[model samples]
Each structure stands twice: as C-alpha cells, then as structure tokens.
Target: MATFQRHRAFPWLLLLPQLAIVAIFFFWPAFQALRRSFYVQDAFGLGERFVGLSNYVAVLTSALWQQALVNTLLFSASVALGAMSIALLLATLADRVLRGAKGYRTLLIWPYAVAPAAAGVLWLFLFDPSLGIISRALGSLGIHWNQRLNGGQAMLLVIIASVWQQMSYNFIFFLAGLQSIPASLLESAAIDGAGPWRRFWTITFPLLSPTTFFLLVMNTIYAFFETFGTIDTTTGGGPNNATTTLVYKIYQDGIVGLDLGGSSAQSVILMVLVGLLTLIQFRYVERRVQYY
Candidate 1:
C-alpha cells in the first residue's frame, strides 16, 4: 500500500498490470469456483440450486475421492523426493567435473525446459507396452512391463516421468546452492582428515539446507498442480484409475463427468490443503533450515 510522496498513484500504476493479471486469472476464477461449490444443477444445465454442503459431503464420503487422495499423497511425495535426490546427485557429479562442464550442465538442464505434456509423451513412448524400446528391453529380461494393464506399473511409470521432468529444476537450484558454498570450509574439513561423505554430511549439507527447504516446497507445489498435464498426456489417469491424483480427479469430475458442484468442492478442498501445507512447512519445517 505504500506509495510515493509526490505522486501517490505511481506505485499503484506500477502494480496495476500484475494486480490485474492475478485478479483475472486467479482471483476471479477462485471466487467463481467457491461460489459454485455449494450449488448443484441438473444434467441439462437448466438451473443451479444451492444445496448447502451436499457436494462437499458427497465428495468427502466418496470411495473414489479417498483413493485419489491416497494416490496424490504417494505420487507427490515420490516425485518430490525422487526428483530432488536424483537432481542433487547429478549436481554433485557435475560440480566435480573439470572438463566439458558447460555441456554437461546444459544437457542436464535441458529437461527442465521441456513442456510437461511433451515430457509425458516422451516417457509414454518409451514405456509403451508393445512398441516402447524400454518396454521391449524389459520384456526381453522376462519382466512384463505393461503399464496399461498393471496398476503398480502405471503408477511407477508416472512417478518416473514426473521425477525426470522435475529433476532439472531441482538441479539448477542445487547447483547454485553448491556453488554458493564457500570453498574454505570444505578445504579446512579436508585438511582435518574429513572425507567427501563426512564433509557433505556436516558442512555442505547444512549450508544447502535453505535451498533444500525451498525446493521441497516448490517441488511439492509442482507435483500437486503442475503434474496434471503430464498425467493427462501419459496415463490419462488410467489402468483402473490407479494413477488418478486429486487434481486429475477434479478434472475427471468437472470436465469428463460433468459434476460441476462436486468438482468445485474438490477444488476448494485442494486449494485449502495446498495452502495449509505451505503454511505448515514455513511455520514448522523452516525452523530447521539454516539460512546463514
């Protein structure tokens, strides 16, 4: 709300574009969804009638919603942990590389720039049961790699694709965090008979805590919201809805099933859950993060 003393409207003018964008794209839709969550309409869309908390009650009590919730938790956690771990390992190796480092870094970061849907398609091609290269290779090894028929295989395939899509983003942050670390502390540790593992555990890891904490939050959000496109393209939440996440469920209800009220209620629940999660992380998780 602060403004210039001489021209009070200048700061407001400067913020107008961003404010307008947020209102149009985020706030307005959210308000509409909130208003709609409490109402129900006939199949033909003749009229909508407010039904108290019927939609919310139905959604919460539904067995499908429960399953989606479980799947979402598993998928989000797997993607966040898997992506961050793989990215950290790659960043560590790249940091130690003395030759062709730029090329290595560029190749590693290329996946981050790939569109989520495109990345999903790439993996889908690689994991297709009959025609996929990797799938055929697995079949040759006596492993039936049919994601289309196997629920576990479908979930695993989605997790791998999601992790690969997110790894580059984590790599960039982790690499920056690694490079920001002062070399002196590491050298002193080495001089005192500390090995790479000990130095990482005691010195490097602590310094990277802030970056790790940040990536944890960002990755959680990404896994929750941004993976929708990837899931849609790859599995379409298929194989008996095994890979169907909460967000995907929302889409299934709203767009596919045409259950506007239920979908809106689910959306509100999702929004609250994500907001609560972020608040919890900042309130509690950040306590362990070392900024200095």
Candidate 2:
C-alpha cells in the first residue's frame, strides 16, 4: 500500500516544479497587483496609503479609460478577425498545393519568428510618409499618407502591423488544422459532385471549428496584451491617444505616469475582463466548436 501510494504521488512530485513556477510568477504577481489596487503608492515608493475602491472608481469613471476600453475592443476584434481570416485562406491554399508545399508553408511561417517590435518597425518604415516606398507611391496618387498625425490612419497602421505579426502564428495553427482533416473525407465529398466552395463550407469549415474557436480566444488575448510592443514601436499609443488600448494605458499609467494604485486597479479590472471573456467563449462558443 505504501509503495502504491508513493507511485501514485510520483506524477505530482514531477509536476511540483512547474506548479511552483506558476505560483511564484503568475499567482504571486497577480496577488501583488490585487493588493496594490487598494492602496495608493507614493511616486517615489517612499510611502503608501489604503484607498480602497477609489482607484477602481477613478479608472472606471475616467473618460480616457473609457476611450481606451473602446479602442481595445475594436482593435482586438479587427486583429482577430483579419489575422484569422487571412491565415485560414492561406492555410487552405497551402494545403491544396501539391508542389512546393513545404517551401510555401515555411515562407508563411517565417514571419512568426520576427519580434513584435521588429514587425512594427518594418511596417513603420514601409508607411513612413516622407520616404517610405508605399507612402511615396500613395503620394503620387494624391492620397496623403501620414499615420503620425492622422488618428484613423495611425489606428489603421497599428491594426495592419498587428495583423501581419499575428497572421503567421494563426497560419501555422490553421494549416495544422487543415492538414488534420482526413483526406478520405474530402475525397468522398468531391466524388459526390460537391464543388470546391460547397465542399469547403459543408466539410472543411465545419471541421475546422475547434481550431478556429481556439485561435479566436488566443488572438483576442494577443490583441489585448501582446500588441503592446507593436503599438509602442509604431504609434506609441499615439496622436491624441487615438490608439491607446487598455494594456497600453496600464503601462503608460503605471510605469510612465507613476499612478501605481490606479494602474493596479486597471490591471485587476483587465484580469477580470479577460477572465470573463474567456469564460463566455468557453461556455457559449464551445458549444459550436465541433471537436473531432
């Protein structure tokens, strides 16, 4: 009995390191953020005071925060949809290619290795109004291109940069999902006189639902948090705070503005928002996500 119990506990023992890492890194910082949310810290970190819900109320009531929230939602939705749609299309095409498929897949996946900041900088150079090739081309066409000053243009640039950076990651997943669908099933559907579009809608698309749902959740989170580097490098949350997202606002307030309590409160709120969003996806969206 003792030996059997020891063996039963062996797996948990092996997992202990990972469990400790999670607790120390993820849970500990989260706890600190929660604790700090209720306390106002002096700018120099020399003093602090318990302010309770005032920080939360201030963040929630602030007009700037409200704008940031809206921007975050719009940015997240656009990036998720744009990246996933393009990725799915590319993956489908790649899967159908009999020749150079490996090379094509490698090219599609290479962009994922580029750092987010690097991706942002690359796009920025391409869109630089004065000297960029694309910008110069647009200039000749009489459509002035200056993202630095135009709020809409800045937002659009950031969205494009984000989508470009994320598309590769989504492509890999979509390609794998596409490849996983049994060829025999598609062959059978084709033999039944189903056209390419009909076959895709009736078979491929439905079968990819699980992967699509998963990517939706991940891409949403990526847009909310991971795009910080891209926005920082490209727009810096930009002209008149047009592209200021919730994550960017948190960094600007907490790290740059030195409003520790308010930022912590914002962080806590963001955590709750992400948690709720994920829960909603899993609870409702999962029903439609067909798993093979």
Candidate 3:
C-alpha cells in the first residue's frame, strides 16, 4: 500500500508547483474579476456599489459596445484570413518551385520576430500622411490616404498591420506542414501524368487539412485577443472609436476608465465568445483533420 501510494503521489508532487501557481495567479484573479463585475463605480472615485447585473446590462445594451463588437469581429476575421491565405500561397510556392528556400524562409519569419508594438509603430510610419513614402506614392496616383477622416480606411490600415505581423507565424506553420508531406506521393502523382494543379487539389490540399485546422484555431484566438498591442499603438481605438475592438474596449473600460464591473462583464462575454468558437472548431474540424 505504501509503495502504491508513493508511486501515485510522484506525479502530483511534480505537478504541485505548476498547479499552485495557476490557482494563485490565474484562478484567483479570475474569481476576483467575476466578483468585481457585480459592483458599480462612480466618477468621483468615492462611490462603489454592489449593483449586481446593472453594469452588465448597461454595457450590453450600449450602442458603443455593439459597434465595438462588430468592428472587433470584422478586423480579426480580415486579418486572419488575409495572413493565412498569403502564407499558404507563399508556402506552396516555396515547397514546389523554389530551390534553396532558406533565404525566403528567413525573410518570411522576420515579421513574427518583431514585437507587436514595434510592428504597429513601424506600420504607422509607413502610412503617415506627411512625408511618408506610401502616402506620397498614393498622392502621386491621386489617391488621398487619410486614415484619420475615413473610418473604413482606418480599419483597413489596422487589418493590414495585423496581417503583416502575423504572416510570419502562418508561413512557418504552413511550411512545416508542406515539408511533412511525403515526396513519394508527389512522385507517384507525376508518374500518373497528373499536372501540378491536379496533384495539389487531389492530394496536397487534403493532407494539409490538419495544418489548416490547427491554424484556424490558433489564428482565431490570436485575432480575438492578442491584436490589442497593434490597435493600442497604432489607432488607440480612435477616429471616434472606429477601430475599437472587444479586447481594446475591455482595456479602455477596466484600466483606463476604471469601470471595473462593466469591463469584467465585457471580459466574460469575450470569454464566452472564444469558448464557443473553440468548441465549434473542435466539433467540426477535429474529425476532418487528415493524418498521413
């Protein structure tokens, strides 16, 4: 009995530290945020009341919240789609056409190495209205590039910046997926007189389904949460809150505005949205992932 107990306890002993840390840092804070969400805050910083659901109701019913939510979803979707599609195209090209692809691979992964804030700042300079190369070029073509005045243009800039930053990660994963495919299969397809396009559609794409599934989950989560730095640095969710995302709104509310309850409610909503997406992805995509 002692020997069995010792064996059983060994794994727990190893995991105890990590479990303790998670409970302390993650769960404790989460519980606190939940509790805070039930309370109300006033402007003078002198009033805090336990209003239970009022804050949530206010936030959910607000027009600004609705607008922000839509903007967030649109921006994230565009950036993920743009980055993943470009990365897949580049990966396919590299795998099939290019000899000595190391240089191109290095260039592709460079953007992923950059910090999000830095990437945002870099993109800001690139699109700056005065004395900016891109702006000047657009001006020469009679296209006035004013991100401040046009909300659609501002959103487009944010999406482009985000996609540029994320393309490297997508590229690396797709490249790895491509490299993992067996060369013998391609050789067999060639022997059968299959054209490149035919082989790619019939064999390559089906095998790449697993990689696509993984990328979709990760990219969705990233778009939903981690694009905040880019938004904050570049747009500050600005131009009359045109670029305000859900995560950005949460930050503005909780940290900047000190509307703890409203912020927490927003957070909980965001969490629920992400959870639903993850669940759907697992349910629909897991079975479809092809393993060779």
* TM-scores of the candidates in the order shown: 0.96, 0.96, 0.94
| Tens digits of per-residue lDDT for model 3, 1-292 | 7776769878898999999999999889888778878887675658788998887899889999999989988988898899999999999988765676888889889999899999888888888888568878998999998777778878988899999988889999999998998999999999999999998888888899889888888888888888999988888898899999999999998889977789988888888888998999899878988877
Query: What's the true lDDT of residue 41 in model 2?
Result: 95
For model 1, state the Cα shift of residue 54 in Å.
0.2
Clashing pairs in 2: none
Which whole-number lDDT from 0 to 100 does residue 24 have in model 2? 100
Residue 267 of model 2 has an lDDT of 97
Q: What is candidate 1's CA lDDT for residue 43?
A: 57
Residues 37-91, model 2: lDDT tens digits: 9999989989999998999999999999999999999999999999999999999
- Model 1: runs farther than 4 Å from truth? 1-3, 42-45
Tens-place lDDT digits, model 1, residues 1-292: 2345878878899999999999999999999999899999765789999999999999999998999999999999999999999999999999999999999999999998999999999999999998999999999999999998998999999999999989999999999999999999999999999999999999999999999999999999999999998999999998889999999999999998898899999999999999999999999999999999
Q: Specify the poorest-scoring 10-residue window by lDDT in model 3.
A: 39-48
